[model samples]
Target: MDEDSIDHNKSVIIDIPTDLESNQWSKCWIHRIPRKLRKVKESAYTPQLISIGPFHHGREELKAMEVLKEKYHQKLLQRLPKDGSVSNQMEEFIRDSYKEIHGRYAGLSNNGFDDEDQAFEKIIMRDACFIVELFQRNDSKKESDDDYILSTPWLKKAIKLDLIMLENQIPFFVLRQLYTITAPHLPSVNVPITQASNHMNPFLKLTCSFFKDHIVKESDWEKFAEIKEIKHFTNLLREFWLPREFIKRRNPQQKDIADRKYLYSATKLDKAGVTFKRASKGTSLADVKISKKPVLKFIPASKGMKLKLPELKLENDTECLLRNVMALEQCLYPKEDYICGYVALMDQLINTSEDVDFLVERKIITNMLGSNKEAARLFNGLCNQIPREKTFYARFYNDLNKFYENRWNVTRSTLKKVYFKDLWTGSSTVVGLFVLVFTVTATIRNVYLRHL
Candidate 1:
């Protein structure tokens, strides 16, 4: 810690132990986004996404989610905030959150959604704090009651009026997040049936298309084009225009469809999944009545999946926004939980804080700007006058300048400042940076001279 090496970090390091067992399963440190959920929106877009009415969002009925997902893959042609925060800040959050959940539950697989009954039952039951507690202590209905937990008065208030299903004890919060569509029908089909769909059923296709066409109908294509800088029908082109190639891929009774969905959803769920069924569902102490023949074999309908946004599942623009919000509210946890959260924050505050290269670049500029005061002093002078709002990139430029000038002696700090600096960027000090590199020949020369 040289006097020349001004402490770049304004705050002191809180050296928490990292001796926890290796979390090979966590991806907080890695560069991967989960597989996208391919949901279709029902009907038109509402500024406030009131389902407006009961509508289906089956993936086959709508490739909109898949379409929106593809757009996420495309460079965000435009965004409101434009700082990369609004669009992707949560993605990294999810990756790390998934990692923490996975590590916390050792030996669990990533695609744990498919076996939601057996696997995630404990997790959801334990984690569903408010609702689970209500069921445990308050619900007066016995397990033998006709409606069971549905008989609880708290449930009626907790669930949205839009939701008609009361039999299955799916968490109301979970149902809301899934964008479940419900009518006053006999069998309430709480969609998100399985993490991903088993079949792109034709009726499913009709349902999805109904929503798709309706959304597109109301879309102001001209206005969207204006924002996105496209020539015409950009909404339709980007949102609905099919990949002429999709027709080739379509086939009924393809054995692979079910397998692909199974494998893909399972793999995605394995990363991070929770069960719809609560732990208290089974209280029967009597000897099990194992039926040799099953009753038309039932698979869990409300299986959970990682909340991949509209981009991967590519829905209409509005739908994408809604789902993205849903994911953040549901899946993401506090940033401090993941290694990336710590590192990302460190990068911001330390390496690329307000005065991004304040310590290193100033030192380099002071040194490499040839002890010259012009660039270095001018930089410091500007920094002192940095408008609070402009300090972010201004400090970046200051360090970047030093990096180029004293490049030969440039430290890792310079590289980070010039290249990435996306971290904190909320810096203040325009300090100094100095990295000393010793060549073998130089070392030998010094040694020989000392001996002589």
Candidate 2:
């Protein structure tokens, strides 16, 4: 072969450093929705009302909110002491922290404003300031009645959903830095932002208010005070929904439930003599348990067994919200895919409309999707792109399967279903047995008399 041809035949090898050896910044939790997953439901991953981060910046559709962002920025600055220096201070902070902010976004390209430091600073400052102002306005005491976004219910809801999208997030520390700078000038509420010792963080309070509908009141934000770093709004929301114990016991290296061969649906378990019971209000959905006794006294005791499921509030936007969170978990925390594991467990438990019905009747699932079929479809679709791996509820699934497989439990369930199919049938059976016994007694007595 010719020397040129020989050279061409040799493959060029480029060595990339391993995750350990690479000086690569930690995995930026913020990421664009992967196309494979996004194709399933594009709208859920895309920002509809407003875009917060660089992922959707400069899109024509989201341009309308640009003016609104500017207005909010001005309003926030207006709240500051009348000195012109506050704007300069904010600009300086953004410039100083620009590198840190840039490092927090995954797959950030240098093509857009990478060389334009001032432009990047402007975008971050404006976006961060707008978010802080929006959160501040959500609190009723500080909100103006005439606010355009707040006045329009649809817009407000859309904005909230948009802000929580994985693609539409800024690092939490960036927002916190901005908040710390402006907190002194902002109006005071029941909890002041300046009190670092207090359990209630102003940033957290703002986030909870913005997503109040999804948050459980039982969430203790005080525990979060000890968390030194939080990734972004999406991460915070995921953490908020988790049980305190789960958070404390969580080990990133621990293997999940991916090894279990079988997972039973609610209906299947019910037929196997396992009674479905709703968990307490504050219980994390991840804390599913199977036990011989009902976890809550309000739930009637049933023979054989009980399965407890945490309360999941379903709504029109729940599917969209959950899908994004699951996607984030899959991308950022593959080893500790808590959200993905939860969705996988739910997918197993809700394979059909019948399963949805079983959960709905027992109050284990609230079907806000207008139909049980729709709710079933929502859950069944979530895990389609998710990798099937060890789930968080593997132990619960394994234990419940063992209980359901018991021969005695199955026989008892079948007998109860057949003999006591309904009240009228059961009553008639009892009456008929009574009459037969009485007739037999009379006949025997007459026979004895005849013999005598």
Candidate 3:
């Protein structure tokens, strides 16, 4: 062999061991958006305001947050112990956590730093401290004049959107480690420090409080108590929307069965005698099902079977939030993709703006995205490159397909639309039918008399 080719082969042989040494799939949570998914909407997956982790660390557009991050880092240092041993402990913990997930960050550039681990350690500490400071500030009722992030309305909104992006995430463990060290020294806020310990993790409590409006109602904060582990912000957001019972009753080995051949839209489902109903209060987004009978058997209900879906509020930032969460599911929980399941179901049910309008009328969707078409496009685009091998709503989709296939449902739906459309139409149709029946009866009686 040529000398150059032999050297190239030797280098390739050495690199294989380096690759396998870092391949810890279980620890891999944070990930770059797969190219196919990113191409569908590049801006949706990219951070607009601030970059949080090593994936998008040195972007020019996000450079503004760097100075602010440093400021927060300095503040965190003042609160934390200055002892060399304590600092070393945190640094070692951060390093080990990053090492476990190093394979996920393999191709990422280290910017100007000579050593990759040194660069990431610096980035994690700064980002984690900033997040910790920001959450605590957001939780506090009183605001400081020097606090530019909270004071600037638009900036605050952008950061919230940016923080949840899959590409822009520090490992949750890093945040947890930092929070554990800083919580004791954190300045007292609205609540007494002693009482704050009542929560499973005071850090989690602060996070939930910060994002309460975006995720759930204030009354539902108690739900977080049941959660045991959180991978990162994106995962946390997904977890918030997942049904509590599903989490408790989930079977890791249980496989989902999807009928990919059958695709039905909202309008089509309606025509097939499926009555869309907004799920009752306190239901999670993952709580979807097809009910054969009405919720209240004694009370009269609409025609056909009922499909219960949780109410979805689509806002300006919802697309970004949902897209990132779906990316998280794609990377970490491919088999148990609850968020993707919900999105896929919605995409199937909303083929057009008409479907969006139909669901909006049923209160299944609160379209704040200005128009139904925009909401329809959002749902349609979400599942463009997503996989559906398994989903949380597979059984629900199967039930819907079965319900739609019944001939009786189509007949009932047709009857309701043609004759029983309104009080006047129904009454007139009933009277007209009675008249026809009476005429036929008279004719039959006359024929019998003649025969006698």
Maximum-lDDT candidate: 3
Candidate 1 residues lying further than 4 Å off, grouped into runs, are 1-202, 213-440, 443-447
RMSD each, Å: 29.1, 5.8, 5.1
TM-score of predicted model 2? 0.84
* Per-prediction backbone clash count: 34, 5, 0
TM-score (all chains, Cα) for each model: 0.16, 0.84, 0.85
Question: Please, what are the lDDT tens digits per residue for candidate 2 over residues 1-452?
Answer: 99987754442211111244544535567877766688799988999879797878888999999999999999999988777777778778888887888877766764566456676677778899998988787665537466788778888888888888999999888888788888888866443343322665677667665666554242445546655567888887677656557677665546645346558888888778888889986676566676676434775654467777787878988888788878888777777776777777888888899999988888888887788888888888888777875766677677778877887677777876777679987888789889999999999999999999
Tens-digit lDDT track for model 3 on 1-452?
A: 99999987875553233345555644567777877788788888998888887878778988987998998888867777777555567677777776654555434546665577788778877888889888887776675335788888788888888888888887676787778866777876543333323664777777777676776455565666667788788888887788767666655436577876346888988888787899998788877877677524675653347888999999999888888888888877887787788888898899999999999999999999999999999998888889777766777778778777877777888888899889999999999999999999999999999999
lDDT of 3: 0.77
Best by TM-score: 3
Q: For residue 263, what is the lDDT in candidate 3?
A: 60
Candidate 2 regions exceeding 4 Å error are 1-25, 140-142, 190-197, 214-228, 250-253, 256-260, 293-303, 420-452
Candidate 3 ranges with C-alpha deviation above 4 Å: 1-23, 80-114, 144-146, 189-198, 294-303, 422-424, 442-452
